[model samples]
Target: MANGTGVAGASAATASEGAFLEVAGLGVTFGGLTALSGFGLNLEQGRLLGIIGPNGAGKTTLFNLLTGLVRPTTGSVVLEGRDITGAKPHVLADAGVARTFQNIRNIRGLSVIDNVKVALGLHESPSLLSTIFFTPAYRSGQFRTEQKARTLLQLLNLDDVRNLPGDGLPYGAQRRLEIACALALEPKLLLLDEPAAGMNPTETIELMELIKRVHREFGLTIMLIEHNVHFIMNTCERIQVLNYGQLIADGEPSYIRKHPAVIEAYLGAGAHDA
Candidate 1:
């Protein structure tokens, strides 16, 4: 996992294959308290990055800041070399970033295909007027987009239930469907918040493989926040550990597992190198 997801060494910029996203000096505050401080990260394209830490470490809060679900009091979010700090959620989506919630939030009543279509239409639609008329060009565009959606569904092994309501699919399938919805946006960067949450061990393993395949097959740059330390270590190339709203460690998993500060602050004294 470290081999696949590791951050490029210092001099990441000059290393060629530069970072797709660079988060620098990110800090978040609520009321009088700080939720994240001096936190930063560099994400290379087509890699998987794991964000992990003990509870209240601000791992999810940092993700919130990245996705613009919550604004950081101070910091800048750079995507594909563009400043996007404080950008609205929809703006970020339009800027080639897509994310999924840890909790299941896909449209429960929509058929699986329609759910994916809704997200795809945002990017592929030629015009609102065209869609309203169902003109040849409009219908033709929608057909191609739907075909892409169906192909993605099949690639995710979800076609067997393509016509099923989102809520009717099994839990594991629903999670994959949520990822499919994110993919429908044709995003360059994907943020997955605990895609394996609430899954059995078998399902978790499969999900990890699916994530890797997404990176390999689609060459997506991914940032993920996961509670399962072992799984994250096994799936992410490099990881960032947060503690009490501060960055405690950032490096390849092997280095982090042995970092004394990370052990004491985020992983606890009992955690060891994988």
Candidate 2:
């Protein structure tokens, strides 16, 4: 449910305005070691951008920096033209940024629908006192919230699991639930990390299609951290390559596949052996 507040129209807004997330000179450090250095990109409105590299390439760390999960050592992160460098996660969410983790973190005690309700709750007002008093506005707010929750569940085809406890879901369904929760926030920029980690090949293909549909229909600007080269290459409009926490390549999938340095840094051994 969306809390009767304005929704970002995630599937359609970017397709038209064509301006979305922008990142520049992004860097991150841990004590003495730099985990991410000078990473940057301009994600066009409504485009799916893939981030890929070997396991330790700082892919997810970049995500942490973007979502305020970690503060950048230096650089700027602007979303929809607003400066949000080092903004709190909730502040970022209120400003139309939402994310799913490398691991799902639904409220294990709540049902699928309740988990989504929490996202919608972020925008709901009328206060605990108002809710306890059952004022007209509170009643209306509750109604709107329920409607929004139902709509989001149906949008993600999780309506059947609405009543089921989040911890009871199958692996793939749990992943989708995390996405559904993020969508409930109606964020303009959606960050998905390892979305296909536990999916089977069939599930992977379907997940790719689902992702495309979400991006195209919702007008979402999607930035994903994924290891599946086929999934990344087939789905993203552009891809950024990271290695040892440094910016190594940035281009379309086709360009990246043929990049000499990229091949040398990542797929060189396999290509040479072949």
Candidate 3:
């Protein structure tokens, strides 16, 4: 077990060759409880990585740390050679990081398009005075924003229900809509937490293809936390396993599937029985 201290002395280092994102000696504690400890990994540009663990394994906590939802008790987060540890969420967003939550988060009252617009609005820098007077610049900016939003919706295959309320869509579409909203941030790194949580086998398979398409089309470096072993095994290029807030294994899917520590600690004894 990692105890609360996590991996020790995982310090920020010179960017590794092709290292787009890196975290070293990352640990977090809530009072006496240890959420994560000694957690560290490197993500290359344009690679899709998956994190898997049993419940209470501090998976969501890691996502929170990456997106600036909470600060870590120890360690550093580096993105493209910049030390972004403890940066605020908005600051991280500005720095090209975006994420979708484990639960669907969207403006249920707002149309699907408007949900995306909210994300775009966060990074807009139009002068308030121009908007007060309805200046051409503001109008033009809004027009361009809408056009880009539409393009993103189309890319994610959500354009058909662009006018529907986000909450009105079926569970899977709502998940896709959330991803579209994240895309509006124009992120270089996108974190998806449990994207296939409620989908059936067919939907999950479809989502797997969609994820691959998104990664190829956008040229993004993506990381996801998913509970579905089959989904992660099939989708991600590399896999990291977590148990008791510690990284028990990290490797390609084939290696991960057979790692003894992973099977004993999290994957369970019967994992290979079938």
What TM-scores do the predictions have? 0.89, 0.90, 0.92
- lDDT of each structure? 0.82, 0.82, 0.87
Candidate No. with top TM-score: 3
lDDT of 1 by residue, 1-274 (tens): 2323232232333423446787767888899889988776777788888888888888888878877899989867788878889998878888888998888888987999889998987777687787777789988888898799889999889988999998788899999999999998889999998999999999999999999989888888898889898899999888887788877778798987777777787545766543
- Tens-place lDDT digits, model 2, residues 82-177: 889999999999998899998888898999999998999889857888879999999999899999999989988899889999878888888889
Question: How many residue pairs collide in each prediction?
Answer: 3, 9, 3
CA RMSD per model (angstroms):
3.9, 7.8, 3.5
lDDT of 2 at 38: 71
TM-score of 2: 0.90
Off-target runs (Cα >4 Å) in candidate 2 are: 1-19, 268-274
Q: Put the candidates in TM-score order, highest first.
A: 3, 2, 1
User: Can you tell me which runs of candidate 3 are displaced by over 4 Å?
Assistant: 1-18, 267-274
Model 1 RMSD, rounded to 1 decimal: 3.9
lDDT of 3 by residue, 1-274 (tens): 1122223346535336658898888889999999999888877899999999889999999999999999999889999888899999999999999999898998988999989998898777688799899898899989988998899899878999999998999999999999999989999999999999999999999999999999999999999899999899999988888888888888888888777778877647777665
Better structure of 2 and 3 per TM-score: 3
Worst 10 residues of 2 by lDDT: 1-10
